[model samples]
Structure formats: C-alpha cells, structure tokens
Target: MSVQLVANVLIGIALVVFLGYRQATWRYLDPTRIWRTPLIMAIVGVVVLAQTTTTITTTDVVFLGIEALITVGVGLTMGSITRFRTVATPDSKGRTIQSRTGLLGAALWIVLIAVRVGLDVVGGHLGAHLLTSTGTILLVLALNRAARAVVIDQRIPRDDREARGMMVR
Candidate 1:
C-alpha cells in the first residue's frame, strides 16, 4: 500500500531470488542453508521498511525500472559465467580466460547505475546529494565485484604447473 512498503517488498524479493539462484547453481551450497536467505531478506526488508518514508517521485520509479533491468542482466551474466569453458586440453594453452561473464556483468551494472544517477542529475538534485549518491553506488558496485570475484575464483580451481604438465622438480 505505502511506497516504503512497496520498495521494501521489491528489495526483499530481489534478495530471495538472488539467494535461490546461488543455492541452485552452486554445488557447494547446502540445502539447509537456503532458508537463511529468505530469513535474512525478511529481516532486511523490515528494517528498510521501518526506516523509509512513503513519498516517492517519478525519478524514483525510473530508478527502480533501471534496477530491474540491471538485475535481469546480472542473472543472465551469472548463467553465462557458469557455462564458460577455459580448457582446450590441459597441455595445449598455458592458461585461458575462465569467463568474461563477470566483467560483462559488472559493466552492465555500472552502466545501469550511471544511467540512473545521470537521470537523477538531469531530472534535478543539483546538489551534494547527487554526487554522494553516485559515489555510493560506485563504491557498492566495486565491493560487489570484489565479492563476486572471490566467490567465482573459489568455485573454479586453477591449474598449476604440475597439473598442466610441467614437472615440479
């Protein structure tokens, strides 16, 4: 009913979807751990909903739309990342690019954030708030990328000299 309630619900749904994808796609994820995702989502949703006021603007709607597009792009990118192949036989190439998916995904996310912030600026907000919000988005993206990189790297084991046909001695 309220704008804050809507935003919180949307964000909560997004978190649940993200967690479901992680659980289904990652072999390491435990089935028991899956419940934690929605629980966390609910907790976050309540907190956010409690803090937010009900007012919203046209720009806010546009921002949410852009974010939805970004979410879809990221999901596709994750699927692509999981399907990439890096080996043309262990003996052939020294090393290969595991996946360009993460980079592509990150780029798409950055573009979405940039467009949203740019629109905010163009729409109004000609003050410190605009710059602060933009900077915050960039920082969040950077941290997200870092976290994703760590997870992905852990999922795929790297072939060392011994594994790739070089003698250890």
Candidate 2:
C-alpha cells in the first residue's frame, strides 16, 4: 500500500474509534458543538484536495456522487433514530437538548462504513481512484455528519416554552 493509503487507513480507524465512542454517549446539542467537527473536516478536506495532484475523471465524479448520496442518506436515518431529551442544566437557561445515538445509531454507522468500503472496492476496479483518497474520504464523512446534524438540529425543540418542554420528562 502507498504511504497515503496507509495514512488514510490509520486515520479512518482513528475516526471510527473516536466517533463510535462519541456517538454512543449523550452530548449537549449545542450548535457550536454539533457543527464544529464537520465544518473543520470540510475545510481540511478541501485543503488536502487542493494540495494533492490527481487526474479528475468522470468515473470518479460519478462514484463520489453515489457515495455522497449514501452517506447523507445514512446520516439522515441515524439522526431520525437518535434519542433526544431535554434536561435541566445550570447553563442554557435552565434546560438544553441532549442527544444519544445508542445502539441502533451505532449500527447505522457501521452500515455506512460497510457501504463505503463496498463502493470503494467496486469503484477501484472501475478506475475511480478519487473515491478512496484521504481528501475524498474526509469530504464524504463531513457530508455525512453535516446531514445528521441538520436532522438533529431540526428535531430540537424550539424556543417556545411548550416546544422546549416537550422532550423534558
């Protein structure tokens, strides 16, 4: 394997471990916390893509498009399945929404990873080199996380008293 490929694999493993743990735990659904990760990943992905020299091909584009769609779809499904509850906290004006992925959401993450790997294998044979690149992987992951965050954010209770209290109890 090339150095880049090895590095990508190591990074992928690290992400799987870290995100897997984080997803299983309950976390405050603050906008900054929810959005920061994907945004940073996207910027880094763009930078990496810019620095790397690779020939662009229609096959690569098509594969990436399919991967992105699946990523977003899985993310949406995960978000919908996530457990959200409002809890009384010292911060956030008395209560705030907290989210936990639990087992089902984690399963979806595995499914997403499996689907990506399967695509990578198929795309590799078809000359879609970009699909498995470090930069492309990061971009796809960011897209997935962003989509999940969108659904979670939408599910959060509004500022209104009734809505905010809906999840409490």
Candidate 3:
C-alpha cells in the first residue's frame, strides 16, 4: 500500500477509537458546543480536498453519495439510541443534561466502520479511488456527526436548548 493510504488508514482508526470513546461516555450535552467537531471536520476535509491531486470521476461521485447517506443514517440511529439525562455538573450545584451512547451507540459506530470498509472494497474494485481519500473519509465522518447532532438537538427541551445558548429550531 502507498504511504499516504497507510497513513489515512491509521488516522481513520485513531479517529474512530477516540470518537467512539467520547460518544460512549457520559458528557454534558451542550448544543452550542456539539456542532464544533463536525464543523471542524468539514473544514479540514475541504482543505484536504483542495490539496489532493486525485481526479474525481462519476463513479467516485456515486459511491460518495451512497456512503454519505449510510454515514448519516448510522449517525441518526446512534442519536436515537443515546441515553440522556439530567445530572449535576462536577463543579456546579445546578443540573445539566448529559448523554452517552453506552454500548448500543458504540455498536452502531462499529457498524458504520464496517459499512465504510465494505464500500471502500467495492469502490476500489470499481476504480472509485476518491472513496479511499482522506478528504472523502473526513467529509463522510462530518456528515455522520452532524446528523447525530441534529437528532440530539431535537431531543433537547427548548428551554434547555436556549439556556445552553443554542437557538431552538
């Protein structure tokens, strides 16, 4: 395998491990802060896309579209299964809502990774190489996280949303 591809695989695995842990642990669900990760991932993905020399083809487009759909679907599923409850913040007497994916959420992440890998195998055979690029992977991850954030935000009470400095949709 090429060095770049190897590096991408390592980075992708690291991200999965880190993000999976974060999602599986109970953390304060601040609507305002939850979107940051997705936004940052998207920006980085765009930057990587700009720097890459890969030629995009129709096959790449089709595969990426399908992958994006699957990513978002899995993310939404994770959000729906997430456990949320009010809890006292470590440093504060007041209670704020916290969320965790626990086991099921983590399992969904594994499913997403499996799906992405399966798609990569098919796309590679079909010469849809962009599916294997770092940019594409990051973009797919951002879409998944964004979809999950949307579902989580929706579950938050309007009062809690506004109190946490998030505009209610």
Kindly list the per-residue Cα lDDT of model 2 for residues 1-169, writing each as its tens digit.
8999899889988998788887899876665556778989999999998887888899999999999999999888877888877776635544466778887777787888888889999999999888778989899999988888777767776652433211223
Instruction: Name the candidate that leads on lDDT.
Output: 3
Clashing pairs in 2: none
Q: Kindly report which residue pairs in candidate 3 clash with one another.
A: none
TM-score of 2: 0.87
Q: What's the residue-level lDDT of 53 in candidate 1?
A: 51
lDDT of each: 0.41, 0.81, 0.83
Q: Residue 84's C-alpha lDDT in candidate 3?
A: 78
**Rank order by TM-score, top first?**
3, 2, 1
Q: Please, what are the lDDT tens digits per residue for candidate 3 over residues 1-169?
A: 8987898889889998998898779887767677888899999999998888989999999999999999999999987887777764532634377788887887888889999999999999999999888888899999999988888877774445443534365
Q: After superposition, how far is residue 103 of candidate 2 from its true place, in Å?
A: 1.1
The candidate that achieves the highest TM-score relative to the unseen native structure: 3
Which candidate would rank higher by lDDT, 2 or 3? 3
- Count the clashes in each prediction: 0, 0, 0
Better of 1 and 3 by TM-score: 3
Instruction: Put down candidate 1 lDDT per residue, 1-169, tens digits, no spaces.
Output: 6564365346435633553444243233222222343344445445543554544555655554554455445544543454334445433433442333434454554454565456546544632222223223333333333344334434444443222211122
